[model samples]
Target: MADVLSILIGLMFTCTGCLLLFGSSISADVDDQLTQDFKRFITVMPLREMFPWRITSMNYRTMAGVLQLSSALLLLLTSGVLSTIANMVLMVVMGVAMYSHWAVGDEINKLVPALICFSLLMIRLFLHLRHMPKDKKD
Candidate 1:
Protein backbone atom coordinates (compact mmCIF):
# COMPACT_ATOMS: atom_id res chain seq x y z
CA MET A 1 0.00 0.00 0.00
CA ALA A 2 2.74 2.41 0.98
CA ASP A 3 4.74 1.54 -2.08
CA VAL A 4 1.79 2.25 -4.33
CA LEU A 5 1.14 5.54 -2.66
CA SER A 6 4.79 6.48 -2.87
CA ILE A 7 4.94 5.73 -6.56
CA LEU A 8 1.83 7.73 -7.23
CA ILE A 9 3.19 10.69 -5.34
CA GLY A 10 6.51 10.25 -7.09
CA LEU A 11 4.84 10.39 -10.48
CA MET A 12 2.99 13.53 -9.52
CA PHE A 13 6.13 15.24 -8.34
CA THR A 14 8.09 14.11 -11.37
CA CYS A 15 5.55 15.69 -13.65
CA THR A 16 5.42 18.85 -11.59
CA GLY A 17 9.21 19.07 -11.50
CA CYS A 18 9.55 18.57 -15.21
CA LEU A 19 6.90 21.10 -15.89
CA LEU A 20 8.47 23.64 -13.59
CA LEU A 21 11.93 22.98 -15.02
CA PHE A 22 10.95 23.21 -18.63
CA GLY A 23 7.71 25.11 -18.62
CA SER A 24 9.48 28.27 -17.60
CA SER A 25 11.59 28.09 -20.72
CA ILE A 26 9.15 26.58 -23.18
CA SER A 27 6.24 28.98 -22.94
CA ALA A 28 6.14 32.71 -22.38
CA ASP A 29 2.83 32.30 -20.64
CA VAL A 30 4.27 29.76 -18.22
CA ASP A 31 7.32 31.90 -17.60
CA ASP A 32 5.22 34.97 -16.90
CA GLN A 33 2.89 33.14 -14.58
CA LEU A 34 5.75 31.51 -12.73
CA THR A 35 7.48 34.85 -12.40
CA GLN A 36 4.41 36.50 -10.96
CA ASP A 37 3.80 33.67 -8.50
CA PHE A 38 7.38 33.47 -7.32
CA LYS A 39 7.75 37.21 -6.94
CA ARG A 40 5.25 37.18 -4.12
CA PHE A 41 7.32 34.92 -1.91
CA ILE A 42 11.02 35.48 -2.53
CA THR A 43 11.08 38.85 -0.88
CA VAL A 44 8.76 38.09 1.99
CA MET A 45 9.87 34.60 3.05
CA PRO A 46 11.86 34.93 6.27
CA LEU A 47 15.04 33.19 5.25
CA ARG A 48 14.97 34.71 1.82
CA GLU A 49 14.78 38.20 3.27
CA MET A 50 18.11 37.74 4.98
CA PHE A 51 19.95 37.38 1.71
CA PRO A 52 21.86 40.34 0.37
CA TRP A 53 20.21 40.07 -3.02
CA ARG A 54 16.74 39.34 -4.22
CA ILE A 55 16.11 35.99 -5.85
CA THR A 56 14.85 36.24 -9.40
CA SER A 57 11.81 34.32 -10.55
CA MET A 58 13.88 32.19 -12.86
CA ASN A 59 16.21 31.16 -10.04
CA TYR A 60 13.26 30.27 -7.87
CA ARG A 61 11.79 28.12 -10.62
CA THR A 62 15.02 26.24 -11.12
CA MET A 63 15.56 25.71 -7.41
CA ALA A 64 12.01 24.54 -6.84
CA GLY A 65 12.23 22.25 -9.87
CA VAL A 66 15.46 20.69 -8.66
CA LEU A 67 14.12 20.11 -5.17
CA GLN A 68 10.96 18.52 -6.47
CA LEU A 69 12.86 16.38 -8.93
CA SER A 70 15.26 15.12 -6.27
CA SER A 71 12.45 14.33 -3.88
CA ALA A 72 10.54 12.51 -6.60
CA LEU A 73 13.61 10.48 -7.49
CA LEU A 74 14.15 9.59 -3.85
CA LEU A 75 10.55 8.52 -3.43
CA LEU A 76 10.56 6.54 -6.66
CA LEU A 77 13.95 4.86 -6.62
CA THR A 78 14.57 4.23 -2.93
CA SER A 79 12.78 3.26 0.24
CA GLY A 80 13.70 2.87 3.91
CA VAL A 81 15.88 5.66 5.33
CA LEU A 82 16.47 7.53 2.10
CA SER A 83 12.78 8.01 1.38
CA THR A 84 12.13 9.10 4.93
CA ILE A 85 14.93 11.63 4.81
CA ALA A 86 13.79 12.94 1.48
CA ASN A 87 10.27 13.33 2.81
CA MET A 88 11.53 15.11 5.87
CA VAL A 89 13.35 17.58 3.69
CA LEU A 90 10.26 18.02 1.58
CA MET A 91 8.16 18.57 4.67
CA VAL A 92 10.45 21.38 5.74
CA VAL A 93 10.30 22.93 2.31
CA MET A 94 6.55 22.77 2.23
CA GLY A 95 6.34 24.08 5.74
CA VAL A 96 8.35 27.08 4.70
CA ALA A 97 6.13 27.57 1.69
CA MET A 98 3.08 27.55 3.89
CA TYR A 99 4.69 30.02 6.20
CA SER A 100 5.60 32.29 3.36
CA HIS A 101 2.05 32.25 2.15
CA TRP A 102 0.78 33.14 5.60
CA ALA A 103 3.35 35.85 6.03
CA VAL A 104 2.37 37.45 2.79
CA GLY A 105 -1.31 37.39 3.64
CA ASP A 106 -2.19 35.38 0.58
CA GLU A 107 -5.55 33.64 0.36
CA ILE A 108 -5.79 30.65 2.66
CA ASN A 109 -6.76 28.52 -0.31
CA LYS A 110 -3.38 29.19 -1.80
CA LEU A 111 -1.85 27.46 1.19
CA VAL A 112 -3.77 24.22 0.83
CA PRO A 113 -1.32 22.56 -1.51
CA ALA A 114 1.67 23.20 0.72
CA LEU A 115 -0.28 22.08 3.74
CA ILE A 116 -1.26 18.87 2.01
CA CYS A 117 2.31 18.12 0.97
CA PHE A 118 3.54 18.86 4.48
CA SER A 119 0.94 16.56 6.00
CA LEU A 120 1.63 13.74 3.56
CA LEU A 121 5.37 13.92 4.06
CA MET A 122 4.88 13.83 7.80
CA ILE A 123 2.69 10.78 7.46
CA ARG A 124 5.29 9.14 5.30
CA LEU A 125 7.94 9.83 7.95
CA PHE A 126 5.73 8.43 10.70
CA LEU A 127 4.99 5.29 8.73
CA HIS A 128 8.67 4.72 8.18
CA LEU A 129 9.34 5.11 11.89
CA ARG A 130 6.49 2.78 12.79
CA HIS A 131 8.04 0.00 10.70
CA MET A 132 11.61 0.54 11.79
CA PRO A 133 13.18 -2.29 13.74
CA LYS A 134 13.41 -1.79 17.46
CA ASP A 135 16.93 -1.42 18.76
CA LYS A 136 17.83 -4.18 21.16
CA LYS A 137 19.15 -2.59 24.31
CA ASP A 138 21.22 -5.47 25.61
Candidate 2:
Protein backbone atom coordinates (compact mmCIF):
# COMPACT_ATOMS: atom_id res chain seq x y z
CA MET A 1 0.00 0.00 0.00
CA ALA A 2 2.75 2.44 0.83
CA ASP A 3 4.63 1.66 -2.36
CA VAL A 4 1.49 2.07 -4.39
CA LEU A 5 0.82 5.42 -2.79
CA SER A 6 4.36 6.52 -3.37
CA ILE A 7 4.18 5.59 -7.02
CA LEU A 8 0.96 7.52 -7.41
CA ILE A 9 2.45 10.60 -5.79
CA GLY A 10 5.46 10.30 -8.04
CA LEU A 11 3.20 10.05 -11.04
CA MET A 12 1.35 13.19 -10.03
CA PHE A 13 4.57 15.10 -9.64
CA THR A 14 5.87 13.77 -12.93
CA CYS A 15 2.77 14.80 -14.81
CA THR A 16 2.72 18.27 -13.27
CA GLY A 17 6.37 18.77 -14.13
CA CYS A 18 5.71 17.65 -17.66
CA LEU A 19 2.95 20.18 -17.99
CA LEU A 20 5.11 22.92 -16.61
CA LEU A 21 7.85 22.01 -19.06
CA PHE A 22 6.24 20.99 -22.32
CA GLY A 23 2.63 21.95 -22.31
CA SER A 24 1.38 23.90 -25.31
CA SER A 25 -0.42 26.51 -23.33
CA ILE A 26 2.69 27.57 -21.44
CA SER A 27 2.72 31.01 -22.97
CA ALA A 28 1.37 34.16 -21.37
CA ASP A 29 -2.08 32.71 -20.85
CA VAL A 30 -0.79 29.89 -18.75
CA ASP A 31 1.43 32.27 -16.90
CA ASP A 32 -1.49 34.51 -16.20
CA GLN A 33 -3.55 31.58 -15.06
CA LEU A 34 -0.82 30.52 -12.69
CA THR A 35 -0.69 34.02 -11.23
CA GLN A 36 -4.43 34.14 -10.81
CA ASP A 37 -4.44 30.76 -9.16
CA PHE A 38 -1.76 31.75 -6.70
CA LYS A 39 -3.45 35.02 -5.93
CA ARG A 40 -6.12 33.08 -4.11
CA PHE A 41 -3.67 31.92 -1.44
CA ILE A 42 -1.87 34.45 0.69
CA THR A 43 0.80 31.89 1.45
CA VAL A 44 1.58 31.81 -2.26
CA MET A 45 2.37 35.49 -2.52
CA PRO A 46 6.09 35.04 -2.78
CA LEU A 47 5.70 32.36 -5.37
CA ARG A 48 3.20 34.50 -7.18
CA GLU A 49 5.66 37.34 -7.37
CA MET A 50 8.36 34.96 -8.51
CA PHE A 51 6.15 33.29 -11.08
CA PRO A 52 6.81 35.53 -14.03
CA TRP A 53 10.53 35.46 -13.72
CA ARG A 54 10.56 31.81 -12.81
CA ILE A 55 8.30 30.73 -15.65
CA THR A 56 9.28 33.23 -18.28
CA SER A 57 13.02 32.93 -18.17
CA MET A 58 12.58 29.24 -18.81
CA ASN A 59 15.78 28.40 -17.01
CA TYR A 60 15.24 27.38 -13.41
CA ARG A 61 11.69 26.18 -13.85
CA THR A 62 12.55 24.17 -16.94
CA MET A 63 15.49 22.47 -15.35
CA ALA A 64 13.59 21.65 -12.19
CA GLY A 65 10.68 20.28 -14.18
CA VAL A 66 12.97 18.08 -16.24
CA LEU A 67 14.65 16.75 -13.15
CA GLN A 68 11.33 16.07 -11.50
CA LEU A 69 10.00 14.21 -14.52
CA SER A 70 13.21 12.24 -14.86
CA SER A 71 13.04 11.18 -11.23
CA ALA A 72 9.47 10.08 -11.60
CA LEU A 73 10.27 8.14 -14.74
CA LEU A 74 13.15 6.38 -13.07
CA LEU A 75 10.95 5.34 -10.17
CA LEU A 76 8.22 4.11 -12.47
CA LEU A 77 10.53 2.22 -14.79
CA THR A 78 13.11 0.90 -12.36
CA SER A 79 12.48 0.69 -8.66
CA GLY A 80 15.96 -0.06 -7.39
CA VAL A 81 19.27 1.67 -6.71
CA LEU A 82 19.10 3.98 -9.70
CA SER A 83 15.58 4.96 -8.82
CA THR A 84 16.68 5.70 -5.29
CA ILE A 85 19.44 7.95 -6.56
CA ALA A 86 16.98 9.80 -8.75
CA ASN A 87 14.65 10.27 -5.83
CA MET A 88 17.49 11.67 -3.77
CA VAL A 89 18.36 14.11 -6.51
CA LEU A 90 14.74 15.22 -6.67
CA MET A 91 14.71 15.68 -2.93
CA VAL A 92 17.54 18.13 -3.29
CA VAL A 93 15.69 20.03 -5.96
CA MET A 94 12.61 20.22 -3.78
CA GLY A 95 14.67 21.22 -0.79
CA VAL A 96 15.99 24.15 -2.76
CA ALA A 97 12.44 24.95 -3.75
CA MET A 98 11.38 24.99 -0.12
CA TYR A 99 14.31 27.20 0.78
CA SER A 100 13.49 29.65 -1.97
CA HIS A 101 9.92 29.77 -0.79
CA TRP A 102 10.98 30.46 2.74
CA ALA A 103 13.55 33.03 1.72
CA VAL A 104 10.86 34.92 -0.10
CA GLY A 105 8.56 34.77 2.93
CA ASP A 106 5.97 32.57 1.33
CA GLU A 107 3.42 31.12 3.74
CA ILE A 108 3.39 27.55 4.97
CA ASN A 109 0.54 26.70 2.65
CA LYS A 110 2.72 27.53 -0.33
CA LEU A 111 5.47 25.30 0.99
CA VAL A 112 3.33 22.23 1.49
CA PRO A 113 3.75 20.64 -1.92
CA ALA A 114 7.51 20.85 -1.94
CA LEU A 115 7.59 19.77 1.69
CA ILE A 116 5.43 16.76 0.93
CA CYS A 117 7.63 15.70 -1.96
CA PHE A 118 10.74 16.17 0.07
CA SER A 119 9.32 14.23 2.99
CA LEU A 120 8.11 11.37 0.83
CA LEU A 121 11.44 11.09 -0.93
CA MET A 122 13.20 11.03 2.41
CA ILE A 123 10.90 8.31 3.62
CA ARG A 124 11.58 6.26 0.51
CA LEU A 125 15.31 6.65 0.97
CA PHE A 126 15.08 5.55 4.59
CA LEU A 127 13.01 2.55 3.61
CA HIS A 128 15.74 1.56 1.21
CA LEU A 129 18.35 2.09 3.90
CA ARG A 130 16.41 0.04 6.43
CA HIS A 131 16.25 -2.89 4.03
CA MET A 132 19.95 -2.90 3.22
CA PRO A 133 22.11 -5.73 4.47
CA LYS A 134 24.69 -4.94 7.07
CA ASP A 135 28.32 -5.11 5.99
CA LYS A 136 30.48 -7.60 7.85
CA LYS A 137 33.97 -9.06 7.62
CA ASP A 138 34.86 -12.67 8.14
Candidate 3:
Protein backbone atom coordinates (compact mmCIF):
# COMPACT_ATOMS: atom_id res chain seq x y z
CA MET A 1 0.00 0.00 0.00
CA ALA A 2 2.79 2.38 0.85
CA ASP A 3 4.52 1.70 -2.44
CA VAL A 4 1.30 2.21 -4.35
CA LEU A 5 0.65 5.41 -2.45
CA SER A 6 4.08 6.73 -3.28
CA ILE A 7 3.64 5.90 -6.93
CA LEU A 8 0.25 7.53 -7.04
CA ILE A 9 1.56 10.73 -5.55
CA GLY A 10 4.47 10.86 -7.92
CA LEU A 11 2.24 10.19 -10.89
CA MET A 12 -0.19 12.85 -9.79
CA PHE A 13 2.52 15.48 -9.58
CA THR A 14 3.80 14.51 -12.98
CA CYS A 15 0.34 14.44 -14.52
CA THR A 16 -0.59 17.77 -12.99
CA GLY A 17 2.61 19.26 -14.26
CA CYS A 18 1.82 17.98 -17.72
CA LEU A 19 -1.72 19.23 -17.52
CA LEU A 20 -0.66 22.79 -16.69
CA LEU A 21 2.06 22.65 -19.30
CA PHE A 22 -0.54 21.89 -21.93
CA GLY A 23 -2.62 24.90 -20.94
CA SER A 24 0.10 27.23 -22.23
CA SER A 25 -0.40 27.00 -25.97
CA ILE A 26 -4.11 27.67 -26.03
CA SER A 27 -5.55 30.85 -27.57
CA ALA A 28 -5.95 34.12 -25.69
CA ASP A 29 -9.69 33.59 -25.24
CA VAL A 30 -9.02 30.19 -23.77
CA ASP A 31 -6.43 31.64 -21.41
CA ASP A 32 -8.86 34.32 -20.35
CA GLN A 33 -11.49 31.72 -19.66
CA LEU A 34 -9.04 29.72 -17.57
CA THR A 35 -8.12 32.75 -15.48
CA GLN A 36 -11.75 33.59 -14.90
CA ASP A 37 -12.42 30.00 -13.96
CA PHE A 38 -9.62 30.17 -11.42
CA LYS A 39 -11.09 33.37 -9.99
CA ARG A 40 -14.49 31.79 -9.69
CA PHE A 41 -13.01 28.87 -7.78
CA ILE A 42 -11.25 30.97 -5.12
CA THR A 43 -14.48 32.87 -4.53
CA VAL A 44 -16.08 29.46 -3.76
CA MET A 45 -19.19 29.81 -5.80
CA PRO A 46 -21.12 27.89 -8.40
CA LEU A 47 -22.12 31.32 -9.67
CA ARG A 48 -20.85 34.85 -9.27
CA GLU A 49 -20.51 38.11 -11.09
CA MET A 50 -18.26 37.67 -14.09
CA PHE A 51 -14.63 38.51 -13.46
CA PRO A 52 -13.66 41.96 -14.68
CA TRP A 53 -10.16 41.31 -15.96
CA ARG A 54 -8.22 40.39 -19.06
CA ILE A 55 -5.42 37.81 -18.98
CA THR A 56 -3.63 39.91 -21.61
CA SER A 57 -2.78 42.55 -19.05
CA MET A 58 -0.55 40.08 -17.28
CA ASN A 59 1.64 38.43 -19.88
CA TYR A 60 4.16 37.40 -17.26
CA ARG A 61 1.66 34.95 -15.78
CA THR A 62 1.57 33.11 -19.07
CA MET A 63 5.35 32.92 -19.18
CA ALA A 64 5.28 31.65 -15.62
CA GLY A 65 2.69 29.11 -16.66
CA VAL A 66 4.97 27.71 -19.30
CA LEU A 67 7.86 27.52 -16.89
CA GLN A 68 5.70 25.65 -14.39
CA LEU A 69 4.39 23.25 -16.99
CA SER A 70 7.85 22.51 -18.35
CA SER A 71 9.20 22.03 -14.86
CA ALA A 72 6.44 19.56 -14.11
CA LEU A 73 7.32 17.59 -17.23
CA LEU A 74 10.93 17.54 -16.15
CA LEU A 75 9.97 16.30 -12.70
CA LEU A 76 7.84 13.51 -14.13
CA LEU A 77 10.33 12.14 -16.66
CA THR A 78 13.52 12.66 -14.66
CA SER A 79 14.90 10.07 -12.20
CA GLY A 80 17.90 9.34 -9.97
CA VAL A 81 20.14 12.31 -9.13
CA LEU A 82 18.82 14.22 -12.10
CA SER A 83 15.23 13.66 -11.04
CA THR A 84 15.81 15.09 -7.59
CA ILE A 85 17.62 18.09 -8.94
CA ALA A 86 14.95 18.64 -11.57
CA ASN A 87 12.17 18.46 -9.01
CA MET A 88 13.90 21.10 -6.89
CA VAL A 89 14.20 23.30 -9.95
CA LEU A 90 10.54 22.76 -10.73
CA MET A 91 9.55 23.89 -7.24
CA VAL A 92 11.56 27.06 -7.59
CA VAL A 93 10.00 27.85 -10.95
CA MET A 94 6.53 27.34 -9.62
CA GLY A 95 7.32 29.49 -6.62
CA VAL A 96 8.29 32.31 -8.93
CA ALA A 97 5.05 31.73 -10.84
CA MET A 98 2.96 31.91 -7.71
CA TYR A 99 4.72 35.12 -6.86
CA SER A 100 4.10 36.52 -10.31
CA HIS A 101 0.38 35.94 -10.04
CA TRP A 102 0.27 37.64 -6.66
CA ALA A 103 2.38 40.51 -7.88
CA VAL A 104 -0.23 41.30 -10.45
CA GLY A 105 -3.69 42.51 -9.47
CA ASP A 106 -5.09 39.04 -10.10
CA GLU A 107 -6.74 39.25 -6.70
CA ILE A 108 -7.06 36.81 -3.83
CA ASN A 109 -10.27 35.85 -5.53
CA LYS A 110 -8.23 34.15 -8.23
CA LEU A 111 -5.86 32.39 -5.86
CA VAL A 112 -7.12 28.80 -5.88
CA PRO A 113 -4.80 27.71 -8.67
CA ALA A 114 -1.87 29.42 -7.02
CA LEU A 115 -2.61 27.64 -3.75
CA ILE A 116 -2.97 24.31 -5.54
CA CYS A 117 0.35 24.82 -7.30
CA PHE A 118 1.98 25.74 -4.02
CA SER A 119 0.66 22.55 -2.45
CA LEU A 120 2.18 20.47 -5.24
CA LEU A 121 5.51 22.25 -4.90
CA MET A 122 5.47 21.59 -1.17
CA ILE A 123 4.91 17.88 -1.77
CA ARG A 124 7.81 17.75 -4.18
CA LEU A 125 9.96 19.56 -1.68
CA PHE A 126 9.00 17.07 1.03
CA LEU A 127 9.84 14.11 -1.16
CA HIS A 128 13.22 15.60 -2.07
CA LEU A 129 13.94 16.54 1.54
CA ARG A 130 13.45 12.95 2.70
CA HIS A 131 16.12 11.83 0.24
CA MET A 132 18.64 14.34 1.56
CA PRO A 133 21.26 13.58 4.25
CA LYS A 134 20.60 14.91 7.74
CA ASP A 135 22.93 17.56 9.07
CA LYS A 136 25.65 16.33 11.46
CA LYS A 137 25.99 17.72 14.99
CA ASP A 138 29.16 19.80 15.27
> Which of the numbered candidates is closest to the native, going by highest lDDT?
1
Instruction: Give the top-scoring candidate (TM-score).
Output: 1
What alpha-carbon RMSD in Å does predicted model 3 have with respect to the real structure?
Answer: 9.1
| Candidate 2 per-residue lDDT over residues 88-119, each given as its tens digit | 88888788778767766768997899898888
* Candidate 1, 1-138: lDDT as tens digits: 667767877887788788888885678897687678778877675576667887786787688888888998999999888888777767767887898889878899989988987777777677678878999998
TM-scores across all candidates?
A: 0.85, 0.72, 0.49
Better of 1 and 2 by lDDT: 1
What ranking emerges by TM-score with the best candidate at the front? 1, 2, 3
The lowest-lDDT stretch of 10 consecutive residues in candidate 1 is: 42-51
In model 3, which residue pairs have backbone atoms overlapping below 3 Å?
A: none
Q: Which stretches of candidate 2 lie over 4 Å from their true place?
A: 23-30, 33-56
2 or 3, greater by lDDT: 2
- How many backbone overlaps does candidate 1 show? 0
Which should have the higher TM-score, number 2 or number 3? 2
